[model samples]
Target: MGRPKYFTPNEVSLHSTLGDLWVSYLGKVYNLTPLVEEYKGDVLLKPIIECAGKDISHWFDPKTKDILTHVDPLSGCVKYYTPRGRFVHVPPPCPRTDWCNDFGRPWWKDNRYEVCSEETLDEILKRYLHYNSHAHSYTWKHNGVSLDMSKTLSENGIPDEDEEFFDARMDRDLFSLSICLYFNDDLTEF
Candidate 1:
């Protein structure tokens, strides 16, 4: 093996732009600039923009194992490439109480908050990779085909009620919303 590379936090901070964005996870650094164009309008884009040129080690808990792979010649880091681009689809409001509970009040409700446009599936995955490995339970693969929620509940040994509770609390749609009146400008106005 060759000698490992080293980068200071300041060095990482200098690269925080769409043209030269870099982020450090674990002990390695990845250049995310190549993904900038493809990730435009994605919910993950906001976090990526915020985290550009920073050591994201603090954002992730150290207990979690590395869920991403590292490729050589790419600075021994994994590139953020999602084959499906944005995976979470913001479905139209459903009448089911379960759905409403997971996504907060219905969009038509006066108290309903405006959803953040930048809460993409990739951002959720990044959070999962950093904080809770168990969140991976929401994903699985079978018979040469992969499914996102194949094991969301079963692997965790969670009861149906607990699963519903988890969905209600951590569901991407609800978690990313801001209590704002106008969906465009007033992201924080309640």
Candidate 2:
């Protein structure tokens, strides 16, 4: 089934089961059913399964979009603060030779698990149309790459620059970032 642009908390709660599990963190909902299927019977899945269909926003740092971490007093080392206990992807407190690090990236960092974001590219384009009537004829892109209209700006590697601009104390009109929009040749005038 195609994922929706938004999922209510109740809708997420409905999928809390071993066969199907979903979780939301840092304002993005993720369907982790495939992870469960892949790591079935693994002890690390206990914490994830226990909080299925629930929002785990508290588990992450909003700025970094990573697990919340703190310095371990005993070892004076920083570690992920998984109160529910360290699950998959999180390294053990003490290094263990048996521990695996072959996984390229953690599940949260993987886009495959993403189900929804705050706004989609389609919605953003519609908003642009309000200002420019011919916006529909232009293909959206970032860094010279075409964007997927079904995904959000962040998913397309378009970082929000408003904060950076504001930090520099530059007026929006004086320092504008350019987004090259090429009119689609296939678009026909009616």
Candidate 3:
């Protein structure tokens, strides 16, 4: 019962693999655990293919930066608001570090968002990867009775050997501002 993604018990069911559906979905070569397998269809590949019309490593980040500025599907608006007021969208992998929304922080005292942006393929891709069971967290806050998205992928896990490369790219930013950025879902994407 969320925006964009309408999932109820009747539309889909994953608890029972229904024969070898789960095992077969993940080929033996991947050696993928259940954590990664369940999301491959409904959350991962389906969106990727739907977006770029290809299954390439679109999830993988490059040395360059990507920009995004999508409109709000719910409000039909194209502006972002925070403690700092409104702003425009940037592409993939925003290097913004000044965002102050800390509710999505891993160390936050309490989470409050039910879902983030999933209006378009790009937004969905970013949130889906970050919201996975392992790589990122589904944070929330309450605007009255409504759940607000605190989707974040700022800090987690071990860094690659090339620490400088990752450092220059990620900017060590948190998910206070729900902008379009490359969610660090390395484990799930692979």
Candidate 4:
């Protein structure tokens, strides 16, 4: 069978949407099922893989057993790996919030901040690869997806250097998914 083609990383909604899907920030659904109640980045995969019913397991994870450790390759977050099946969540915000790595300058400046561990990096890269080639514009996807104009830069809050950085998130900061979360999927066996 042919591989699935994804919308290009240009699609802000799609990029942001799928990025969130890979690592949700809100909360997990009640039980577990592919009928994910969370929009994106809602800890859907791990819960579904760990506590979900048997129906949708195959589509998400079957033999994978633990899903929390599963992260998107392109998401660019990482942490230490433990045998307990516990994996770390490594979205950009985590490094900044928890590790204080994002205090000054854009994240691209520091190698330490980029250290999402070797394994975790590989995983995120693989997931990101799923959409690198596909031609779709994130710019169009972000349009009115769930935008709030009032909260964009506060009277040109974007500095000259920072503008380029923030702009990458959404179309002109309109849909900046600046805040996101990761999952601690139940990869470990009890």
| Best model per lDDT | 2
Q: Estimate each model's TM-score.
A: 0.33, 0.61, 0.15, 0.15
Model 3, backbone clash pairs (residues 3+ apart or across chains), number: 12
Clashing pairs in 2: none
Model 4 lDDT per residue over 1-190, tens place? 5322222223212312222222111111112111233223444234333422222111222222222243445665543222233212223323354443333532112233211111222233345547642211122113234222233222223322323433353233243433122323434322
Judge candidate 3 at residue 84 and give its lDDT.
Answer: 24
Using lDDT as the yardstick, the better of models 3 and 4 is: 3
- lDDT (tens digit, per residue) of candidate 1 on 91-190: 3222344322353432212121111122223344455466644443443333333433323322333322323433354432233322111123322311
Tens digit of per-residue lDDT, candidate 2, span 81-103: 99998898888889899998998
lDDT of 1 at 89: 21
lDDT for every model?
0.43, 0.80, 0.28, 0.28
lDDT score of model 2?
A: 0.80
- Please rank every candidate by lDDT, starting with the best: 2, 1, 3, 4
State in Å the error of residue 172, model 1.
30
lDDT of 3 by residue, 100-154 (tens): 4432432111122121222433344454665654423322322222222333122
Q: Least accurate stretch of 10 residues (summed lDDT) in model 1?
A: 107-116
